[model samples]
Target chain A: MDICDLGIVDYEDALCFQTDLWRKRVEKKVPDTLIMVEHEPVVTLGRVADESSMIDRELFEKKGISVVSTGRGGNITYHAPGQLVLYPIVDLAEKKRDITFYIDFLEKTAARALNRFGVPAGRDEKRRGVWAGGRKIAFIGIAVKRWVTFHGVAVNINNDTTPFSGMHPCGESDIRVTSAKEVLGRELDMSEVKRVFAERFVEDFGREYSSQFVVRSS
Target chain B: MGKMELRLPEISAGGEDVVITLWHAGEGDYVASGEDLVEVSTDKATFDIPAPCYGVLERMIKKPGEKAKTGEVIAEICTDDI
Candidate 1:
């Protein structure tokens, strides 16, 4: 998989970039790519998200964080400048063609990436994200078009988790959100996290997709 | 001319719940092969099911917000050209 790092982009900018790339991928004009981005502080709501999921709107407004409704599946999520968001644009038709398995793969892949940094993380069966010591560490929400995928996973690396409290993160009101920094008691290097995550993502995909699936790590 | 049934493909072996979230085409609308017909979402992923062949959409069996099952017909397309 090719890797493109658009560092500290606005949410709308990344969305447009991902949309264009997604269409290209669907048309088979481009190879499968992994897009890494750290979005400016923003709260995003999925297509099926209901208004009731939002709470504390003033917190975001006071912080000047923009709220945007997006097309990914899930309820609500917050993204910030330090969050490590990985948007893997893959063609699943040539892959396993299973969205559930794909999502699960994303969660597990994120868990492994976090583990590489000494953060013990794994997927929660009841909730659909990576959890570490009962605190949600990563969020997985994706959108697919014509068997091609976009809008991948987001892991709380060195980001602010305060805005997440404003909305029910992934629609779970009682969920406790944590970051790699909080877990390890030190701020993580963003570039290092990206490198590890890119490596782990490539490794897991290559293992699952067999020899024909060629993916080079960043 | 024949009518083709667009079935919801298997999203997972884990019995993950699927719901039809959006329909891009309506009854009497022409859709090309590979054109998105509807959007279905599982727990954490949303997928757009494309039209299998060029045709006019006859009707939708699964509307937005309705549960979808693997292999169940979600919409019908008439294969006749206008």
Candidate 2:
């Protein structure tokens, strides 16, 4: 598990980098790597998601936000500055190869990170993500192939929450969205958040396999 | 025993948060197990969230186009009576 924090990058560049990295890693072109990055505001649609999910596509385009369709499992979501996005291009076959378990582990790791920030985030038994005080604070969507994982979680830090109004987030209509900064009523240092996340990932992955996990920086 | 939290699953390479593009199942709908419940979008790609457990669609926490964090609940499924 190599952890590389790619501080704030454009959405397109990061996407290209992840896809290429995943392709290369699958073909033995790269080592196990965890790349972190933040992106400008953008909306992405998933494979099975319907176009009707987007309430106002034109409005988003007018604002210079791009909407892209992807191959992962889940609907649309937003990405912007102040949010920490992590892409773990690791060979899941080398790490037990259980997709469901892997997803659960991600949720647990994210919940733990939030807990470290005193947010008390935890997994909801009925749904699939971490929650705090009845509001969603994080989102996870990923794709796995030949037991390898691409695409990861997004933890809200200081990003704006207004754009979320354009669509039914994750296809649900009643839930209110929130962020770490909003929950804590203050801004968090992005660097510190990334550090805690990296440490938490190492701990979570190590505990899952009962071995010492080393994160290599790219 | 209480409301379950639905978190986002990794769909693409970058760590960028996605925008909610659609919701397949709406509130109060009877969703079976393994049904496509919701869809979330990211800059690199899009993905659909399947129902992990079966029950009635109870509540929706987030709407389309909204940014969902990695492990936050986007909706709730009520299985208490089912």
Candidate 3:
């Protein structure tokens, strides 16, 4: 896997980038890539995001956050500067070929990275986000095309969590969205966080697991 | 000529509700090999199941909004090749 560092980009432009890469990946033109970015404050709604998942548009509008509908899985979620968004353009057909495993892989990667920060991060299967001290800290939302994957996890390393209050995150009504900064009570350097996360991801995404290993592990 | 069976492959981990979201190829429509035949949602995301071979879509066993299982024949295609 390769890393593409795109500092603070608009969500739509980033999506276009993913689409282009995804097409190339399907065409065997590029290898798997991980794109790390910080997005301008925006709310993205996925396949399961319904009217019930989003209640107050005014909350976003008052804060100048744009809401977008996406093809990725999961529900309404918020993103902004200081949040580390990792979009892994991967080909699962070349690996395990399981959606659930891929999602778990992402959650584990984030959780282990958070552990480095002493955040006590863990996974909640029901809500599908990594939690720390009972507060949701890292979010996972992904999309796969022709067995190639895109649209990935967003970890709250130092981002503002105020916009998350505007919607029911991941369609869960009673959930608290916390950040690494809130959990640690100290601001972190964005570049360092990205570096740690990328390293953890590359490590956890152990290469060439046997087909039996994938079925058994997953 | 052969009738190709189009089944929903194992897209999710296991036991996650997989639903046929939509059909990209209509019945009687000519579909190329590897063309996306349908869109299905599993684990809350959507992915396409491609046609295995160039053929005319002879039947659609699964429709949009219907739950599907892996290896379940979702469609049948009659190939043009001799």
Candidate 4:
């Protein structure tokens, strides 16, 4: 497995890259991969996302935040620079061919990674993401095709959560959103978070992550 | 010719049930081996089940949105080769 770091890219560009990698992975052209990327502020809708979940749409437009609908299964979520999005393009046929287990693995992987940063994040039994201090700190929405996985979990490291107030996070309007910086009361280095997450995934999931491409935001 | 059962695959461990979200091949549809035959969703994720062998989808024991246990037969396919 390879972990490719593509820093601070547009959300659509990252999705396009994920799609290409997903195809390659399904076709057995490349090894399983985990892509870590930070997106330019945007709000995305998952497969089951509802437009009514956005409480204030005009506010997002004025702030230049784009709304996009995706094929991943889940609800609405926000992304921005400072957040670490891990898209794991893996062939499940090569591992445990269970969708439920894969989803749980993703949540557990993020929670374990956050633990390394001294943030005690865990999953809410009724929810689908990682939470800390009674607020969600990570979100997961993934899709699988031909037993291969794509679209993955995102952890809020030091990203802005103010925009999240305008929309329901994963269709739960009452949900409070937080970040690693918010919990620790300090700004966190995005690259460090990415590195910790990559290492934690390898440790927790027992997969070899090859470091091939590393890009940093200028 | 005999009918081969298309069992609800071992979707997960611990014997959890999954909901059949959709059936790509209806009864009487000729499906090729390795082609996607149905879609099933667990609590958080959705995945497709491919045809086990080239045959005519003779019967559907489970429909969309129906709950099925892992390893339970969900459909049957009539094949001369088998």
Candidate 5:
């Protein structure tokens, strides 16, 4: 699989770009690709999200931020510059068409990445996403068409956590949001972090599905 | 002066379709931008869709608990002003 790192981009533009690329793949316009990037501080409402998911819309508007309703699965989550978002435009039919297994693999990859950073992260029994110390660090939301995957997870690394306070993250009002920087208590190298994450994703996904696809670094 | 169909933005990592679970507003109701328009459910979770633009909801082609395929028009917003 080819990995393309898009760097930092506007939230809406990134989503739009991914959607367009996803369409092209579905229509056989392009080869299956994997995209990685980060988005500006934006509040994304997921497939099962509601207005109640946001703590204060007025507050977000006052700050000149945008709220987007997306088709990805999961609740509301914050994506910002320090967070790494991965969009794997892969044909799931070539692998396995199990949605549940895909989600599990994503969680496992995220948790493994966190573990490499010396932080203990795992999946919650009842909740989705990867958590560290009972606080969520990575949020997963994705869509699949004709077995091709688009959109992906956002792992908070060096991102500011203040904006997350404006929403009831993942639509769960009781859950607290955390980041790798907060857990590590220092800034992390973005390139290095992405390398580790990409590696983990490729390793875990390949092993689970027994696919021979290599994770290309962007 | 024409009606614009409002479709669900693509959200799946695999780019799959979502199902309309509920309609927060009814047909003929006025909705402001960012207001809840409909609810969608996927395998991972259910999501509430917000109005993309401020206008009167002209019609709801899909009802509650109905399957809303991606890029399919679930409703239309009548925009005479813009």
Candidate 6:
């Protein structure tokens, strides 16, 4: 597993990069990878997002937030510079070969990482994504091609959550969005958060990405 | 040449039941090996199942919007070149 931390990437550039990585992994050219990045403020719509889930077009334009249609499974979601996004390009054929299991793994990994930071995060069966209290602290929307997964979890670290107010998040307008900073009452080091997240992810799926195969970006 | 069975693969964990969402290859259509032939949703998300071998689609045991189980042959392909 190669962990690449692309600091402050544009949303469209990240999508193109993920697509290329997905194709490379599908062809067995590269080992399984986890691409981590924080996007410049933007809103992305998944395969099922409809007009009702989004806010007015002029509002988004005025705020300078770009709206993009993503290939992942879920509804509309927000992203910003302080959010930690992890796109794991994992080949499920060699692992569990099950989408449900893979998604469950991601949810577990994120929850465990949050637990280490003294934030109580868990999964809600009715609503996907990890939550702290009744407010959502993290979101997940993935797309798998040929059993290789991409477009993963987004964890709010210290970002301004005001932009999320512009639309219905994850198809629920009343859904509350929380962050690690809000829960901890202090801003955190993004790199340290990424470190803990990477460690927990390895702990969750270490069997597949063993010590000998794991790679980290400097 | 024999007929190749295109079964509803076990794409999700837990249950094998799924809903046939789409069929890209209809009966009598020539499909190449590894081409997407059908799609099914397992109460979560839709997944496209690819053809196992190059052949003409001979039959569709399961139609779109119908319920199916894992390992059930949804479609059959005559492996003989058409």
Fnat for each model: 0.78, 0.10, 0.62, 0.48, 0.20, 0.22
- DockQ for each numbered candidate: 0.75, 0.06, 0.57, 0.41, 0.12, 0.35
lDDT of 1: 0.88
Candidate order, TM-score descending: 1, 3, 6, 4, 5, 2
Model number with the top TM-score:
1
**Candidate whose lDDT is highest:** 1
Model 3 ranges off by over 4 Å: A207-218, B13-15, B80-82
Task: Give i-RMS (Å) per prediction.
Answer: 1.3, 8.6, 1.9, 2.3, 7.4, 2.7
Kindly list the per-residue Cα lDDT of model 4 for residues A1-218, writing each as its tens digit.
69899999999999999989988987899998989998999999876667788999998999988999876777889999889999999887777666777788898889988998899899878778999999999998887878788888988998889999999988887899999999999997777888888888867666421211121122
Higher TM-score: candidate 2 or 6? 6
**Candidate 4 residue pairs that clash:** none
Model 2 C-alpha lDDT per residue in residues A124-208, reported as the tens digit of each score: 8777667888877777778765456788888787898778888877776777778888888989888899999999988888796
Ranking by DockQ: 1, 3, 4, 6, 5, 2
Q: CA lDDT, every prediction?
A: 0.88, 0.76, 0.85, 0.84, 0.80, 0.83
- Chain A TM-scores, one per candidate? 0.95, 0.91, 0.94, 0.93, 0.91, 0.92
Q: Model 5, range A6-118, lDDT digits (tens) per residue?
A: 89999878878888887788677787676889887788887778888888888789988888888787788888898988888877777766566677788888899889988
Model 3: which docking level applies?
medium
**Candidate 6 CAPRI level:** acceptable
When summed lDDT is taken over every stretch of 10 residues in candidate 3 chain B, the lowest stretch is: B40-49
lDDT of 5 by residue, B1-82 (tens): 7788898766544556767767888888888887667867775644556788889999999886687766888899998774
Error of 6 at A23 (Å): 2.2
lDDT of 2 by residue, B1-82 (tens): 6455567765433344767767888898888776678866543234557776878778878887688866677788887767
What DockQ was computed for model 6? 0.35
> TM-score of chain B only, all predictions?
0.91, 0.84, 0.88, 0.92, 0.87, 0.90
Worst ten-residue run, lDDT, model 5 chain B? B9-18
Error of 1 at A174 (Å): 1.6
